[model samples]
Target: MVVGARLEGIQLSGIRKMFELTTERSVNLGLGEPDFQPAQHIRQALSDAVEKGYNKYGPTSGISNLREALANGARKYRSDITANDIVVTTGSTQALMITAQYLFNPGDDVLLPDPGFVLNVPQVRIAGARPLMYPLKQEHEFIPQVDDLEKLVTPKTVAIYTNSPSNPTGGVMSIEDIRAITQFAEDHDLWIVSDEVYDQIVYDREHQSFLGDYDKVIHINSLSKTYAMTGWRFGFLITKAPIIDKLSILNYYTIACPNVPTQHAALAAMTGPQEHVKQMVNEFKRRRDLIVDRLNRIDGIHCLVPKGAFYAFPKYDFNISALDFAMECARSDLICTHGSAFGDAGEGHIRFSYANSMDNINKGIDIFEEVCEKIKG
Candidate 1:
């Protein structure tokens, strides 16, 4: 059997490729994963759910209790959203895929951020659309400028995909930036897909949502980062009833429903004591500060202080290409993502995730500093 021609232009994520190439002895600083495990209460909830026989297929929209709990939690920030507006999916990745499939037709162009998540471009292509990139310059704290977005929009542009507390860079969009983007979407009648998986992990500022000002925004979130439940494969979307209806059908065809036991655990994560979240955020903040400070102190590597999330995107003074630099690091047993994996504009940088222990982070830096000396221009 022949593969589909649509996949001819797409390639494997460079991040995952690098990850696979690393040996067991490698000190990983690549993937944006939380080092913490799932909270005890959440794990116990899943265990209890399994013992109580909640293993059957659930409603495609989600189990009702979890949906209501999610709605209530979300309403604390976005008051207009209701239980009817949320649909649980396999993960935020799938939530994004559903949004793209629902909104984009073949050849439709969707604006995404440069120096964004590695998966964003491929996901857009899988939906049969062209991906247009808007710059998220380091000088601008990695926030997308409205003027750049406007320049990229054409009649074929159908949507804008945004990630706050962005992956590959821990840059959180400012409230002013959010307002400008929401207004732009309004003026152009374009759908807005907001990836907010890291909403709970912001360091020094409040997490702003496009949902606060517009119903046209589709908000996607998950328990992965916040609760350290990456393997759980649970995520969801918040939108109005009509969109929810369309997503429900799409979800049915795709996942049938999110895993039942995990959904119960996700409900516990949403409605249980939130102090666990605060604790995790605090730990991540500590790691973020430690890593960023260490990186900035290196002679040729300068990292911007990330306002949220747990990554440090540092620009380097090295003359080598990002790919060669990353591979060189790997040879030294220091694993990291090359910035160019995210987009063309990411050529001169590398993304380091502080999701490991403080001890590992410190150890990694010692090796990183040594590698920098070798690669110094």
Candidate 2:
């Protein structure tokens, strides 16, 4: 009855714990899942696939149509990618895990942004590798500073994990920053694992994929956030076919293949009319503005107005731990993720998702303000 040493450092996600408190009465600010269901056309696509007996195992690299569609989508951002470079995955989570497993050896150091997606550190750890944290400074609007990342590099460093329109913070990296990071990766001969799941959700800026001029970047994307298809478990990875060959072998042993009908659903998600996506982004932007404004009106609280994504990471001057604050909020029928759940770098903050309706968001803020007052006294 021996557990693997590779999993010793990993724990269940803190966001999951906060999610358990959700009820009809609770204002759920935790978890980044979109409140909307997949558009009717996407569901129709899934139904059509199932009716056509598309439920069998798909190729490990995914169906050819879906792969081609994904490549076309990538070309809108980076012109050189092709279907051969794409490997449809079960989800961005699995794609990231497979990439980590393929790119890192035991005891290798992978640089990760502190206060990153909660799974980022654990994914590296599960690969029998160490995660070195680079600061995403509050002073820098939560963007990773090149100097800070450079200072953390060591002989064991093998890769850098980057997320734009970042989770919890909603900070999108600029073109110049992307170029600097890409140049740094080139200079060091390190691989870049780029998480661009929120590529379509940015408000003020365009997404600049690290793969723009860099062949060293491995791009991870998902239909979950873009098409509101989280439960469908569909995503894909982009890298050279040589790396895709290795990841396909890993996939054969892991998921065997992504769900067949869901891949068809994802194909529809990719090639279908993109107006639904644009509408979703507009709604999210409105909610983001609403939540940031409401949080800023609270005394001692300052929320950095996010440039992209639907989550806001708000800093507070309260003299309490983030976990304690979150627990108290949960007791008051509010569920928000604690900042420390992200990392030590996030200790004094809390993450709020604006994925819910504007009415619910306002209600949640009212509850949050009341809780703040109660705690202050």
For model 1, residues 1-377, the per-residue Cα lDDT tens digits are: 35787777788889998898778888899977888889899999999999999999999989999999989878867887788899999889899889888988898999999988877888889888999999888899899888999889999898898999898788898888899998998889888889999999998778987778677889999889999999999999998626789999999999888899999998888888989889888888888889988999999888998888888889999899999998988998889989999999898999898888899889889998998998874
Candidate number of the best lDDT: 2
- lDDT of every model, 2 decimals: 0.88, 0.89
Candidate 1, TM-score vs. the true structure? 0.97
Off by over 4 Å in 2: none
Cα shift from native, residue 19, model 2 (Å): 1.1
lDDT of candidate 2 over 51-166, digit per residue (tens): 99998887998999889999998897788788989888889999998998898888799999889998999989888889999887678999988899889999889999999989
Q: In model 1, what is the error at residue 133, expressed in angstroms?
A: 0.8
Question: What lDDT would candidate 2 get against the real structure?
Answer: 0.89
Q: How many pairs in model 2 have backbone atoms within 3 A of each other, for residues 3 or more apart or on separate chains, i.e. clashes?
A: 0
TM-score of each: 0.97, 0.98
Q: List the residue pairs that clash in candidate 2.
A: none
